[model samples]
Target: MRADNSQHIVEAARRRSEYTRSKAVQALRALDAAGEPVTFETVAKQAGVSRSWLYAQPDLRAEIEQLRAVQRRAPRSSVPARQRASDASLRRRLETANERIQRLTDENRQLRAHLAGALGEQRAARSHTSPRGAASMHEGVDIADPVQPQQPIREREQ
Candidate 1:
């Protein structure tokens, strides 16, 4: 008859269970500390244990559920509440941007009107200098170069 060795086998099983439990607890702590999501799958993977085994542990299961709930309720942003910009600050920035856009639009409109008037004056000067039925004096002139008026020379009175 074989000698009874059930006691030794039972002792080894208990030790294995204790070791596994400790590993799961450590994994839970690590995940919580790192601000990572605390799910049973995550804890099981980190601990190198089976999900079924983690679910069987009542204390760990409860803690995991509580942490998961808390995480769901908490904000997901990495930035702390104190460092976030206020609503008023955002609104003021938007208003300033809009004002700058309006000012630039007005400036662009005035510049375009001034350019049109100068081009009209240049065309009139070209027409007056060219006789009827003759080629225009400004035929080869580039429109981009604005026409400058010749200043009248004032004679000094002796």
Candidate 2:
């Protein structure tokens, strides 16, 4: 009688083992069909088994390692497009700002040179004038000759 009970228990355990193995295999096939990475956690979760079970199973553990290796060797060239576009925009804006700054700097230098030349000419004219007229000439406002006031060099150029 005891032998009969022992055989029954052994048979039941074997059936349970076969069911677990079948579940793991089915999960692995589904993952492969979906082109998903077959890791221990993924397989265990899909198969409704514990992670320890997968780790303890030599075949499953080896398969998971092989899949992980394949994942590492796979080519991944998926960069975020928005980030690339933003970087390009930042570069263009920086170039434009630099160009504007260079133009303004050149304009400032030209204006300074023109101011120096005008001052030099005024000094030479003062040297040829009488002292009485020279003192009055330095004033920007022409009190006596307001009818025909002096025009600036920029306006004369136009």
Candidate 3:
């Protein structure tokens, strides 16, 4: 139009694109160095750019993909390999737990048997001490004696 500043505008746009690309690269490196996951969204956020823009750059896209692939292949656990528990150790722990459970089960069975015997003895003693006509609280009838028929009542002669 008046001064033909299209060339200047193009140069400015090229510089801005280069600046944005540099920021993205720096962000990617920072993330990698910090052991943080490198992805388009993270880089975009770190660099204050759009994910679409990062994808549009072939070099940046390739780098991000490569890093992501590496991360996927790497173990996700926080524990170091050397510090992790071995199979033998885990097996031993399981065996110990099973043994303890078995011991507890046996103890509980013994305790229940002892309690049943004590209660039976107590009930028998109570039945022997109670009056002949009195009913036992447990069975609603005397355990020591069998049921007896009552004699018929006869009217007295006047």
Candidate 4:
């Protein structure tokens, strides 16, 4: 009776071990398929095990994850690769655009400075000229000899 009971226990333990290992593999595969880094919590949830249990089996975790990585790179799909390349291209384009914007901004500042200097010089020249006040006076207004404004000039001997 004792021998039979021990055999039964061994069989049960073996089955449990197999079940746990299969679960770990499936969890690892799912994580790899998602194209995301695996975490203990995510693996535990996928495997239907406690996080502590998953962590306790380091060798199994490493082995299963290694296999998952191999499977992930085995000519499966091109979507991730294309997305990576596009992301790199977008980053480069953004950097180029920023540089162009900076250069244009600098050029605009220099142009503004030059225009201001030219305007200042023009203002200084205008201010230096004498004001022409008598240009708008009426032709009939006489400045000298107001009473006899039309009389001819008379010469006197010294």
Task: Show where candidate 2 strays beyond 4 Å.
Answer: 1-3, 75-158
Kindly list the per-residue Cα lDDT of model 4 for residues 1-158, writing each as its tens digit.
33458888999999998898789768866665675446667777888988777767888667555644644665454233214446678899999999999999999999999999987786566556524322211243323334533332232112
What's model 3's TM-score?
0.47
The pairs that clash in candidate 1 are none
* Candidate order by decreasing TM-score: 1, 3, 2, 4
Off by over 4 Å in 1: 77-158
TM-score of 1: 0.48
lDDT tens string, model 2, 1-158?
Answer: 33458888999999999999999978976775566777788999999999999899998888777765665565232322122346678899999999999999999999999999998888678757734353334555333345556666467459
User: For model 3, how does the per-residue alpha-carbon lDDT over 89-128 read when each residue is reduced to its tens digit?
Assistant: 9999999999999999999999999999998898788768
Q: After superposition on all CA atoms, what RMSD does each candidate show versus the true structure?
A: 13.2, 15.4, 12.5, 17.8
> lDDT at 31 for candidate 4?
66
What lDDT score belongs to each candidate, Candidate 1 first? 0.78, 0.74, 0.80, 0.65
Instruction: State TM-scores per candidate.
Output: 0.48, 0.45, 0.47, 0.38
Better model by lDDT: candidate 1 vs candidate 2 = 1
Q: Clash number for model 2?
A: 0
Provide the lowest-lDDT 10-residue window in model 4: 133-142
